[model samples]
Target: MEFRQDINGLRALAVLVVVLFHFGLAPVSGGFAGVDVFFVISGYLMTGIVFSRMEQGRFSLPDFWLARGRRILPALLAVCATLLLLGWFRLSPMDYKMLGKHALYSVTFLSNFIYQGESGYFDAASQDKWLLHTWSLSVEWQFYMLYPLWLLGARAVSRHPRAPVWAVWAAFAASLAASAVWTTRAPTQAYFQLAFRAWELLAGALVFLHAPRLQASPGQRSALALAGLAAIVCSCLHFTHDTPWPGMAALLPVGGAALVIAAARHGLWLTGNPVAQALGRWSYSIYLWHWPVWAALAYYGAHRQPAAIAAGIAASVVLGMLSFRLVEQPAARLLNRSGTRPRVALALSAACAAVLLPAGLVYVLHGVEQRLSPKVLAIAKEDGNRFKDRVACEFHPGAADPLPRCVLGDRKDVRLIVWGDSHASAVVTAVAEAVPHGVAYYGYQSCPTATGVHYRGWDNTCVAFNEAVLADMRALPPQAPVLIVNRFASYVFGKDAGNPEPVPGVVMDDEPQLSTRPELEAAYKRRLIGMLCRVRQTGREVFVLESLPEMTVYVPNHLARALLRGERPDDVKVSMADYRARNAVVGAWLQEARTTCGVRLLDPTPYLCADGWCGGSRRLQPLYFDTNHLSERGNRVLLPLFRQAFGGLGARKLAAQPAATGQGG
Candidate 1:
């Protein structure tokens, strides 16, 4: 295949958008479409190579696999090896374990499946993952392994003049349909899985297979090329993290890439630009090295400022250039010069095994925590053990077990029913520790106390669970105090009040009729009012626990990383003003409920924050396991406040309470 400067320019464009998006640069929210562009480019180039070889009656699977190994392995190996060395010193034991697992999967071309099973691409924790970008490479490599065989089989079965084209189109249609359906039903899987993503490459393959018959006039070609560029630029600018991706939304960028490739033979200006060509030459290395650089800067707490980000970008560019020159180019020359495909393949396999051996050992040893001090290892271990004691008491949505055990006092009388989301579960530990009366902990992940509202990406079972909890509430004894708690700001104002945009996987449940923030808030108030009325009708007392001050950073992970760097954990505390701002809307609602429905409102902010700052840790012990959920020790610190909120339950009654037995339904 002849070198297409336009294609190289396209590569430049793709990598630029992806790098900018990763760097937290604004206005490129949909910059992730760059990966789709790369997918199409891979499809086009691979198809051209395979089809041309097949037509010449000289196609060899070993040769094709060897070429792919030479093209991809050298740069990827360099990145993996570098990350392994850095991660040993920089990452916490638990994080290092995860990194080792990811590295092991990545070396074996299985990172896509691993990541898909772990979390969504846009999740906050994904930023800490050093090799998250390799998932796409895994998907592409999986395709390469399958596509050639599929093509050979199709060629053997049919002698029709257009058999190859028809086969490609059929596969494209099937994969596109799967993408559309799976993106909505199982977005994380659709994003990472090769089955749903194959259509993108097949779309490019269609262009390659039909190139001979795709001729257009110079004027037509110019128009098509410009339209394609516009489509790409528009999607990159307008699409956001909230957009349901690789569904119909992906067509704009994928089609744009196909159009650009199809029209490049006719001389498009953008694809032939000098800057584009230069960037294109380094695109692969940039893609490989940029993410690790970003993740490392983030781990070191240097990514908060623009100067640090700029420095990281500059470093990425320099490293990319050097890798392309020093590693990728020479490795390719050395491998190809051998003139023996089997020998090259065997050598590449040996190199891959060499890398995987250490990665596997790391996974087996569970990150080798002995490298860190006992104190640091203890902190890292707390991440997994934080909520283990409370697990039996907390029930998941859709569970069919009997109600959770409510034992607390010696008398074992159920007087309090804690109901809300995961936030409530965290508080239950504190309430259980302080209150003499038994408390029934009825908490489900992401299921808020409000009725008639639904989070966009949450399972429908949350609605069922809320209803079940309401039914359970009706069964509680008269005058039982129902404690309601949640991360209310997240659902109401969304991360910030001034910019109340709906998060990607969280939207109004009402279909075909999206509700505005005010509308949703009003609906929530009404539901809460009705719930309060029902509880009061049963003569039960109601207490609404105000949402805690949310931290700007996850305390445990951030502090651990900071400790590794010998930095003060206190430097990352959240401001009181920031907390107050985020909770303003929910605080007002709680006030309204207190006034209108006669519910008692308990404010924990006074206990958690003071003197204009909300500290994330108390005496060097992390207050939270993550950004919001309080750690066990942190929760124990809040026991006195919880006791006071329960009508100053006397010390005699508190003393009468037995030690927690850790029994549950």
Candidate 2:
């Protein structure tokens, strides 16, 4: 349980990388490895304490938990309470409501699981989370609850010989293998799951188990410390978000941290280093405090301001110092005092309950709207339904029911069956313009239009639903134009400059295999032709609508701000350059299809952004209602584009007159 100065330096290293990455600095793409470094260090320190005590025959569960509570709770409570109070005035209804749920989860040490169940860690949706970093703390706490007992059980089994070490190693190997498999099967789940993450901790545990030998000589120890430092630095600089994690990729940081800890006792360079020792002292507090500050800026949409961002980072450092002095030190002393720890723990737990109970109730009731704005409530309801709709579609909501969840647009003279997942669902309001009021809209949300491509994530119902759709398409009128569109970015496979290099795992149907731009273009061309051939067999003309442009910021939130400031909605659109660039790539691939297979590529660039200006929302109208999804108002603007692509439809004729104006006010 002795302090390791080198580990603190590692913490400084991890926090520095994470902060740099969050601030949008260049090429620290593998900066997320800081979390992995922390994970290994946590396991090492925590297991060290438990194993040391168990060997002394003095281990107690209550004492162990009290120590953890003292270590983690004070700062966490401070941040969550601060956020809750600030949310009262600063947050929008939806944002505030989301905070309430997070507050509840934070108190219960379940935020990671909650986030995993909702937005996976890499999702853009996760940025709005004020307590996203709390998930890691939760993961650690969950590990602590089970880890000590496992250690003790193994020790007991071997009659206190080498059983515990063997047990730890076995667990490490098993967990590592499990993590490797799960990383590819479900990367998000792999990132958050305790089972998958346990191996990272075990890597540290194994180091602690062999601590005596690792700390043998000063010369050897210095080398180990330097190697550990190098490994962590390399991980921070080279590892990225796309890196197949918790697999073999995580070994560098985990191993590095273990080496640092094992070498610190004998290494004069690390143990005597003033900066390393100082950072090590405040590392725990810094880790707890820094993320909430960064997350708060993200939640309030203030992360773009360089000055505000600098101030926020500085504030986090100040808070960490304060917590170390005023909270962590005092709480640790109190917990160490005989017979006082349990009572203090009970009181803190009670306080946590007091905060969480009301927050949970608020979330359950969906309190952000204050019930005055039914329109906002309606939109929230619709958004909630979209997730359910996605699930249902993936599970095959049936045609045998009284009324199908989705109906194909079969009644229109030119039946335009728009298809894809939620990306298509978002644009259905715009696509609906081509259909008469009574026409059927058949595509279900999350149900991809790909006929032969099998999805592995969902239930077997997806296969059946896909087969049914193909069968229905075979029977459709030949005059119908089937439009295939989905969020192709989700399926795109390549080295992500934004994340670390990905180690491709198991190959599945529809998984992208191309590594280069030329290879990707070729694959895209083949996929398009394959899709086109399938549609032609069904005797339908196919209109492949290339993906639409998206704004740099959250579209609805950004548009809302513009409207609030009285900007012209038509003048707020971003430059069409990026959108055009992406399409140019896709279009190049589609050219072969256009020449040989007669597939028409529809690009809405000119109409979506007329005369070099892509517009924003006005006081009278909203542009994008979601990140990339256009609003009803925004879709109305794009009606001209839709009309041009399909031919013979006007924006005026396509849009129904709004019942009133000044919405999103």
Candidate 3:
């Protein structure tokens, strides 16, 4: 097969967009389409190789696999080794364990499956993962493992000259149909799984199979090339993290890439340019190095700043260039020199095991905690246990009744009910410590205290859960106080309040349409007022905790890494101005409720935020686990405020009680 400068240029374009997107550059919000571009390119190139060889009756499975091994393994092994070395000293025990687990998956080409089981690619935590980008590589590798066999088999069995092409088209159609269905039903899995992604590669195969028949007049070629570029550019500009991906939305970039490949014979200057060729030569190495560089910067708290992004890109290019020259080319030449494919395969397999064994050990030994101080290790380990108590007290929508174990404090004299979402669950320990009598916790995942807010993603079970909590609250004693704590910013602003997903439903009361921000805000306020009025009518005193300052970064993880490096952990606190800005609408609604609905508002900001900074830790203990939820020890920081709010209930006498402790939910 002859080399195509235009195809190399497409590689350059794809890699550039992906790097830019990963850098948090604002202009290319849809830069994720770069992966789609790569998928198409891979499909076209690989199919071209297989089809041409098969047609000549010279297709060798071992030779093809060996070639692929040479192309992919060297750079990937180098990157994994480098990350493992870096992580050994810089990562906390838990982070190191996760890194090792991911590295093992990366070497085995199962990272996509592992990551799908763990988190969505666009999730905030994904930024911390050094091997996250390898999921795409894994998907491609899985496709390569089977695609050649399928093509060869089709050629052998079918009498039709274009049987292989027909087979590729059939697979493409079936995979495309699955992508459409699974993308809506299980987007994360669809995004990472081969079954849902094969159509993209098949699209490229179709382009290659039909290339000889795609002759065009110069004018038509120019128009087609321009249209292809436009399609790619538009998708890159318009798509976002929220976009349903690699399904219908993916067709734009896949078709565009296909068009570019089909029209490449006409000599599109931009696709054959020198700069494009250079980037294309280094594209694989660049993709391998960029993610870990970005992840390292984030670990050290440089995050999305211009300086950090610049440094990461510079490091990636330098490292990528070095790897291409010093590692990849040399390794490929050495592997190709071997006369037998079995020898090359054995050598590659041995090298892969050498890399994966230590990674497996790291996971088995739980990140080797002996490397860090117990104090630092403790903080790092605390993240896993943050939700323990909530898990115990969780109330389901259709359960028989509220479990007695859900009640905290003195269950014999239950006086208050803590009701809301996970935010309500988060402060259960502090609320338990502050009140003399028992407090029943009714924490349901993603269910807000506000009434009539419907999440498009949530089923009726969420609504039923909210109703169940309300019913329990009405059953409380007349004089008992009901403390309503939720991450109110989410409902009013329709933003993720450090939760992985958006709150399931939209506010549907005032504006059933829920069409605009103002309308959503108004709807949220009305729902909150109704919730407050209902609780008051039940004769329970209503106390609403003002929204806590939501940190933009996961504080504990950031602090853990910083502390491991002997940097000042306190430097990671959120600014009061930024916290207030994010919560402004929720703050206004809280004030309105206090003034108009006769609800007692408890503000923890004075303690949590001071001197222009909202603290993320106190006395070397992390205050919040992730971006917003208070840690077990961090929740104690608000105990004084809890005391003041419940003072009318004679909490002073209970102050002598030892602070309650329970496993995290």
Q: Please provide TM-scores, in order, for all candidate models, with all chains considered together.
A: 0.86, 0.79, 0.83
Residue-level lDDT tens digits of model 3 in 1-665: 78888788889889989988888888899999999999999999999899888888898887887788889998899889888888888888778899999999999899998999876567667877889999999999999999998877887899798888888988999999999999988888899999999999998899888876976887787788778878998888999988998889999999998888888744777777777788889999999998888887777768668888898888988888899999999998888787687788888998898889989988998888788887788777666546465665776555554432367766545667788777887788788888777777777766677676655445545556666566654445556678988887765544454452343236463355566666666676788788787777776678998888887676766667778899865644778887777678678777877787688888888989889998877665678887778888778888999887874574423222233222122
Better of 1 and 2 by TM-score: 1
Order of candidate numbers by TM-score, starting with the best: 1, 3, 2
Task: Provide the global lDDT of candidate 1 against the true structure.
Answer: 0.78
Model 1 TM-score relative to the real fold: 0.86
The Cα RMSD in angstroms, rounded to one decimal, for candidate 1 relative to the true structure is 4.2
Instruction: By lDDT, rank the candidates, best first.
Output: 3, 1, 2
Instruction: Report residue 562 deviation for candidate 2 (angstroms).
Output: 7.3
lDDT of 1 by residue, 136-226 (tens): 9999999999999888878889987577777788889999999999998888888999999999999889889776677688888788878
Query: Is 1 or 3 the stronger prediction by lDDT?
Result: 3
lDDT of each: 0.78, 0.64, 0.79
Clashes of 2: 13
Best by lDDT: 3
lDDT measured at residue 274 in model 3 versus the true structure, 0 to 100? 78
